[model samples]
Target: MQIEPMATATEPTRKIVQRDPARTRARILKAAIAEFSAKGYSGARTVQIATRAKSNIRMLYHYFGGKDALYVRVLEEVLLRLRAAELQLDFESMEPTDGILKMFDFIDTHFGARPELRRLLAFENMNQARHLNRSAVIRDAASPVLGHIANLLRRGEQAGVFRPGIDALHLYTAMVSLAYYSRAHAPTLSRIFGTDLLCHQWQADHHAQSHQMLLGFLSRPTTA
Candidate 1:
């Protein structure tokens, strides 16, 4: 008995457990986003995503089903991040002109901060939005943004600050396109122009120019 007691170890055996399903799912989604953004859907690998998440391919499949499904979820996650942030802004309560500028600023800042989103959009466009089209979540989330812009335009019109017949879709598209192009094509544009568009000074100038262009458009009287 004394000899047996002398051989005993003090440490207890450790057991691995899936303690946090939500956290694991979020990590997988985040890893998927990074992988898809960098490699595009066609080039991205589930094994890479799993490794990035510090998880296994089996776990990734368990959480997201597979690569195509994971890519769609990544798209949904990135888009929803912007949509969720928009809901936090009280654009309706602000003066229309102020709201418009604020919205532009938010978008400019967001695009600057989330270059991955631009890459994702570019990749999706190349795919002709095959995955994006599959997502009703993305479709549903997009509507409210157009509605918000429409509301802002209506308020601005009532206040005589914005021109009539300014379509929300057109306005929204213009704003996003300008912001997207500047950063997305920064390397090429900068090389072509011989100036660094990615630099803070240039970006600031672009932001100001964009503000002026949009506000000027809104201020112009429409031709009958």
Candidate 2:
């Protein structure tokens, strides 16, 4: 009698592997953000981002198509994240001046936490079309908040809390200028001031001073 292969009572079974696409995608995005922020769109390399994400370039392309598409996705994700955080603010509860102060505090803290974000945004400013074309969702999401902020300015003017004849658009641009310039040019400012302007202590002082300066300007009486 020819003996066939005998079945073992205790056979090891192969385990099924499951990959978390969401987690992997998030990791890729975060890595891409850092890469793009540092090197910008043209200089950024997919291999470096993949290595940082503990992934491979093939997967990155599979998820985001290519480098340009990946860059756009990263931009969209960051813009959405920032907008979501800002939208949660309880603007109605605070006085107009206090709301403006809070805005400064928010910018200082948020931008401080993510210097890379400012870098990426600065890069976008250099190539407006490349980034702006991918920013439709961001603009749509921001429209309501912008409108709300404009309304707040109108209310403040009417209440005599802010000076009359100050354009809301101008004021908004001014606030953004103060925040963006401080952080974006921190290195140059640090060299000029002979101190690190990006330090937490410096940022705190700057934030307070900026808020005071803006409030003072807004409260000034208009010339006849």
Candidate 3:
């Protein structure tokens, strides 16, 4: 018995296990974004999101309530990230023309980084009031960023920099439309245009041209 102590099968080695709730939540959020982006809120399913997240339905609900709640949370998170990025532009230091260009650059980068955001937003627009109401808390949170942009526009107008007659809100809407619509509808546009409208080179050129065009439209007129 003591002889060669029957080499006890080294107690099956055990791998250390670590639980990462935060990481799991992030994974769920990421999967939810893709799911909702692909199928609008009405069409999106919680089980699908959970499955994509490699998580269980019960865990998904526990973390984010039901589908509607999860959709709202996803939108809120997206808006928060967008606001943070937009806020980094130092409008106070930038000339109106330069600021407008900076905004275009910012939007271009944002869309590139999060194409799904545009898709998700397109879905939201299909049922504007319903989705907006569901995410009202996030919209409320966005007021500060909106106010900051409005203030910048006011200052630009007062300083005789930006065109005087354009409404800031309208201008903001136009800017957003320009940035989002092209990419969002790229496939359709490419088919109609008989070219790859979203090709890397095309997008780069289009972005620069669009930024220049907007800047030209917004800049103060030169008197003869």
Candidate 4:
């Protein structure tokens, strides 16, 4: 007689509990930033973002609508993060000159520390700010800092410390470019000069230099 195989007990399949929508959205955004920062907007994939987020593509769409929308949202979120840090500076509490100089120093720390934020900015710049241009929220987020810079300049002018008729936006743009230049061009600069701008000492020294240059420009007398 042939022996029959013994019957096996089948185990019940475990059901995945649905994560809260808010949590899932946050996770997707976090994962998308990593994905976008690593691959840039044009190269990022929704499926890979979902995989990195530990969710499904369906869920990613459910949270952010689509890839383009998600990419735009990623840019918004990164700018919002940077703006939030800037908003914490309390520029009004300090002396105008000190505040302006501190802002430059803060940029050194903020931009140097937040490499992903810088990468996103660089990527967005490469795209000619097309994605960044799509959001009104960015304007709102940026307005406060520009306003603070304007206020700082006005106060300096009133106190006869800063030069008269200085355009706040121009000065603000100059400060950013000066503060951002080293980190933005670090690889090329380091190769050329045989010095690493990424080093802490170099960053600190450059921060001082930026602070000095910006302060000097702001305080210099206007010649007709």
Off by over 4 Å in 3: 1-18
User: Candidate 1 vs candidate 3: which has greater lDDT?
Assistant: 1
- Using all chains and alpha carbons, the TM-scores for the candidates as numbered come to 0.92, 0.88, 0.84, 0.89
| Highest-scoring model, lDDT | 1
* Per-model root-mean-square deviation over C-alphas: 2.7, 2.5, 3.4, 4.1
User: Where does model 1 exceed 4 Å of error?
Assistant: 1-12, 16-18, 220-224
Q: Give the winner by TM-score: 1 or 2.
A: 1
Predicted candidate 1 versus true structure: per-residue lDDT over 1-224, tens digit per residue? 45554665678879878568888898889888888899999899899888988889898889889988888899988999998997788986799988888888888899999989999999999999999888999889889888988999999999888988999989988988878899999989899999999999999999999999998999957669
Q: lDDT of each prediction vs. the true structure?
A: 0.89, 0.81, 0.80, 0.86
lDDT per residue (tens digit) for residues 39-106 in model 3: 88888888899899999998898888888788888888887788888888788787766776777678
Off by over 4 Å in 4: 1-18, 222-224
Which is superior by TM-score, 2 or 3? Answer: 2
The full ranking of all candidates by TM-score, starting with the best, is 1, 4, 2, 3
Candidate No. with top TM-score:
1
Q: What is the alpha-carbon lDDT of model 4 when measured against the actual structure?
A: 0.86
What TM-score does model 2 achieve against the real structure? 0.88
What lDDT score is found at residue 171 in candidate 2?
69
What is the Cα root-mean-square deviation between model 4 and the actual structure?
4.1
Could you tell me the lDDT of residue 6 within candidate 2? 83
